[model samples]
Target chain A: MSEAFSGPVAGHVPVLRLGDVLMVTLQGDLHDSTAQQLQQDLAETITHSGATGVIIDISGVEIVDSFLGRVLAEIAAQASLLAARTVVVGMRPAVAITLVELGLTLPGLRTALSTEVAMDLLTQGAPRVGVRRESP
Target chain B: MPEHTAEETHGSPTHEVRDFLRRRREQIAQRWADEPLFRSVFTVSRDEAVEAGKAVVDALAEVADAGRVDDPDAAGFSGVREQLARMGVARGRAGLTAAQVSSELATLRQPVENLLLSDIGEAPAEHVRACATTLTVLMGTLRVVVMQTALSEGEALIDRQRLQLLEVATPVIKLWDGIVAVPLIGTLDSARSQVVMETLLQSIVEQQARFAILDITGVPTVDTLVAQHLMKTVAAARLMGAECIVSGIRPAIAQTIVHLGLDLGTVITRAGLADALKYALHQLGADIVGPTANGTGHR
Candidate 1:
């Protein structure tokens, strides 16, 4: 899928279609501007494609500062509102360190090792709920 | 030999007086050369001694040729003796006193003294003082340069450390199928919060998932700053239209959150991974409709 916004600062944003799933790979630094562009692009892609699930591949990024992380979280929240599932893929070691050091945690976020694994999980059958407990 | 009047007094007595005068002049010259103070001040080596001797002899010859010594009592050696004494006093004040220099020469003997006179000569006080000052200045300059170099190296090291942190922070993979699972390990500060936020938001848009599971079992504790950042993330997620489910709340973290009075009112929180997974399944409309024993179900 093409980027929602294009400019000198925009890096490569690749869109791939696997069966009914649509995967977008984000490469390089995802600052505020970049995140906005990605959000715009994803919104457009989702509107037209009718893909069941979407995956974001971020293996190439070395740093994910607070602003960029917020953008990603917002994207997931927005996409869920539109009835599409979102998955994040491929976090490097440095990014992991910064996240922990900064004490910043995502409340309800899913992660996969690779884009293929994420796609498999997304297309899998419904999740099994074993039991239900009444609220105390 | 018979003295008549003063005008006739000459002859044999004159010859004896002349010899006495010559002896007195020689004695004065020898005394000046032997004086320790004078020798130390001048630091005269063999060449200087030879030259001084030749000059004295030449002056004496000129005086004799001029016939200035008509009588022994009138001989002019007193003036030369006074000049030598003055030279000794001046040299002594400059730390070139005759006694000290003579002792040094005695230890080194004639050969070394001759080398010093021919090559180095006597060092003046002004020259010595100037050399010392120059050395001090150079040493100070060198010290400053060394300190500056060390400071620059330290700055570079800090920069490298920050870069290394960034290298480990970027997230590359996410799965947002039925549930969103974010496994967080390590302390969370403001800078890292941004990274986590970006990764999760992007993952949500890409995966189109309904429920997000944030597992923080790896975290040891939660500080105020970190807690605030988490709250911000939850808020941002809501704005994006995704539901955030926090899992893996350690007991200590729960206590801290309560103690700090952090309001996590809107976000759903679970105590462990199993509970979070159950909630995730339910939120995705995968609730078990018909249950067989042992958690088996058809949605």
Candidate 2:
């Protein structure tokens, strides 16, 4: 969270805005502070950029400790509250096993095998289960 | 019995045993072939048993020469270890207890000792006793080697059978364009359940399947642990961007699960394979309908 205070100073991991969809690709070993900052940044970007969807690519990440898993869940939850859908994509087989063994099922998060599928899901509106609507 | 061989100048037990074995190798092999252990294994040909016996004698002699006859890892034992393990397993299958097998091996030493008595002409009591003790120690080590090898061989065989069992137990089959199913049979052990999860996930990825059905129709029982395993697999499949549905939960098993207070709410389950397939089909906006009266309604 020092990174959150520094404001993108260690901006190694960039959250790209693609046609109103935010794409965050996590690569290699992510520091705890980096994940915290990313969570903050994603929340802010979803609010400011008016992005309707978020795609988190984790193919390059070999391990997802419980902290990172909770962070991913948090990112999805935060995006949901802001009326943006989040589809995590490109999760490696090992990472899935580790997360499942760790009991961090990331209950509210949606996952896709590939980025294209995630993008497709992001584009489709109210087509499947787990679709959330804002309370009046 | 004077303690003297023509070649004995008060040498070590290793030297004496090695010399004695070399001199009486053929005679000892012949006697051992008639013993129950070799006799049972080499039932086809007596010559075959004699050859196996010769190999063992040679290994023992080599070990004694190396002065490592008491060590189970003695290099000489490796040659005969596989054959010894087979003999031990066969004996075990024949309903002989381990103590009985060890005693059977003790019978083999008597023939060699009888020869030793003739070889050591006019030998001193102390020298003769030392030679006999060395031979006994060597045979004891051989018994240990056989037991260790047989135990490990048994474990390895079980491991192999388990792999084969899993191969037939869990198979991921594609049900539709974006759906797959795994019909798990038998019991849900920790190892097998983990494999079930892995194979289900792999099928989901390779087939790009949006839905996976784990049909446990053939699984006999459902305990709290098994329920937890099913939930874990469902959760894992979801993490891989697929919805996992557990089906074929017997009515009795379902009641048991609820009684055990297992929370299966996270897992979407179906009554049977057909129901699971129907649920998946309906989710995919597809359905099955029977033909109407005129055979004109088969859509």
Candidate 3:
């Protein structure tokens, strides 16, 4: 889980491909620039790998400011465009409070309690009644 | 020469004043009892009134004996202030108004003056003047103490009211077996939100509720801050493993949210409490299944 990414750039978000699902585990504080770069990298990975589902584990990120919140939403929106379902997993309690306080409700964003649950949600195929999903 | 030696042999000027007051204690107290205003104004029992009057005279004597007659808050006058404050609180609780107490205190001086004049008839002119001045100053200190007690009583009342308001503002109610709703009213500041969050979370665990509804209909408006407070509450509930449903979005509030472009994320929101409850019930896997004798049941 603590493995580093050997990509061209240092501190680049590690995007691991798991079978048909692409898993990106976010750790520590995410600066605005870091979020922006992650957004671009996630979109590119989803397109090149042809992944049908993208799971983002954010249990490690301590604070989700408005900018980072927007980036997460953009990632989810972009992944869906590339025919992939995006599920954010493991949002901490304090992070959730800060996110709401920032007034970034992450509207239309899909979330799960853990990476396991996120995987379950992805494997279930299609979202429930009110949950947002990629249009068929 | 005899008078000067008598004064020098005595403890101090305060000693002379205290000696004079002690000698006339019974007389001053009797005069206080005889005053028409004393009986009319004081709400305590006749015996208690007499006792309180005697205590005041004794306290004044102690203040004069300490020799710092000009300073009411002096350490020497502490006992005097304590006696007067006790009298104030006792009379206040007995339904006596501060005005009545003030007027009664004024009448007390008349008796002391009469006693002072009669006692001064034998003393030298200079000694008489010094004693009168000390007694007058001590009386003023008593009055200050009484006023302070009145202020403290009013402050206590306001503090209790604030607590009552907090209790009334956030009420956590069990809407169903596994659902709790916290109806928030009034302003939602950081303080009130903290209380709301604590009460809701505690209720969730106690009721083992799977769903919580935060009905904000009583909340008059939805600004960015208010919306943020609501969002924080929902997030906290989610952490507790209970689904949160926000209800009571008026037309004006909906407009405000859209105008601000605030994203509530995927937190479920409904138009009214009933709708939120309906959604909560569905999430709990409970169907109405037609109203039954035992209320409703889970399918």
Candidate 4:
């Protein structure tokens, strides 16, 4: 079971694996259905593997609307609940604007320039967990 | 000039008949002073009163030539005198003295210089009142028409402006697998942000998608208020069971986040869409790799 969790399957979505860090690469568009499947698979992986962190790669996606952006944030929250850190990598410039406009920021999810950078950050040490101040 | 008695009236030429109709119209217009509705809205100004007085004197000349009155000479003279009196009153209201009013009226009655000057006195206020009522009606109608036109054009302009703003602010795209993407490209002012939020929420519920990604890579900067709105979207997504990922953070934006002292410590941050995707897959355990790696680069 652990070996099967090492990398993405041939027919399934592509995910990158580097030692303790797992990276999933999303290609094409991410709407509600795709986001749901991604969330379910990620949650199971965190629960089963006891892996410390997960990284999502979105370099191939051209456009991202509000719905897809929300999914990414949800994954982070879910991963945190399962005692795993979530990181997203390679977001496009246009995608960034849409997310900000939609106000879709993940509270604690670590974002990186690339999968390699994300993996590097995860493996180096305990991820710096910044505490959010409660809004009065 | 084979003018005859009453029997000849029936054989009048077309031109004569037309002339008769024109004279009848003039009479009706002259009698308009007695009509209440017409009088209510029209108030004749001093200039209009003087012009009308001149026109009445001119018409009397024509009527006198046709011998329509029993005593044409006396009637014509009396008509001129009456007009002069009316002119006097109009001039008085315009701040003219009795002598000035008389001089002005005399100049207007130049064509009828032979008219009797008897009974020529300052015109009664009622004459001015009648002229004023007629003028008021004309001005009021004109004002109503102008206002209606302006209001209609203003509404059209507002609608056009609204459409232009929406076109500039929103970008919609449909991808494969029943997924639709609506990219918001601009600074999310509070108002614009609300529109984006409402649109996405409606689309997700309507489309019933399993995954939704909100990539804000085009965003130049994110302040605390923007960050808070993002948090709200994430919460909203959860309620629908649709996954939401935030992607794209320029170094500048990240710096702003830190500088603004926003503790997005609990919020998921993605450098770009790729990273968000990788993390998303890992969560689903769709990672073919053994459970050794959690699929997210963050440890």
* Model 2 alpha-carbon drift over 4 Å, by segment: A1-10, A129-136, B1-8, B93-100, B291-299
Model 2 per-residue lDDT tens digits across residues B17-131 = 8999998999999999999989987889999999999999999999999999789999999899999998889888899998888888888888888888778756667778889
Q: Residue B88 of candidate 4: its Cα lDDT?
A: 36
Q: Which candidate is the best by DockQ?
A: 2
Clashes of 2: 7
Let me know the DockQ for model 3: 0.09
Q: What is the lDDT of residue B22 in candidate 2?
A: 93
Global lDDT of each model?
Answer: 0.57, 0.86, 0.74, 0.53
| DockQ of predicted candidate 4 | 0.02
Model 4's alpha-carbon lDDT is 0.53
How would you encode candidate 3's per-residue C-alpha lDDT over B1-299 as one tens digit per residue? 97887577543557766887788887776677666544544555666557656776787777677776666566655554655666566667678788877776776776787787686667666776776776777677667667786667668879999888888889899988778998888778888887788788777757766678999899988888888778788876664346789999888988999999999865799999999988876665454566568975433
Instruction: List TM-scores for all candidates, in order.
Output: 0.37, 0.88, 0.63, 0.36
Put down candidate 4 lDDT per residue, A1-136, tens digits, no spaces.
3455434432346455566666798888554555677788878777777788898888788787776767777888888898777777766544654565566644455665446546755776543211111211
Question: How many steric overlaps are in each model, in order?
Answer: 72, 7, 2, 115
Across B31-52, the per-residue lDDT of candidate 4 in tens digits comes to: 4333332232235543443345
Clashing pairs in 2: B1-B122, B1-B123, B2-B122, B2-B123, B2-B124, B3-B123, B3-B124
Predicted candidate 2 versus true structure: per-residue lDDT over A34-91, tens digit per residue: 8898999999999999999999998788888999999999999999999999998877
Query: Which stretches of model 4 miss by more than 4 angstroms?
Result: A1-136, B1-126, B133-141, B144-152, B171-181, B281-299
Ranking by lDDT: 2, 3, 1, 4
True contacts kept of 2: 0.45
Candidate closer to the true structure by DockQ (higher is better), 1 or 2: 2
Which candidate has the highest TM-score of all?
2
TM-score of chain A of each: 0.78, 0.84, 0.82, 0.76
Q: Select the stronger candidate by DockQ from 3 and 4.
A: 3
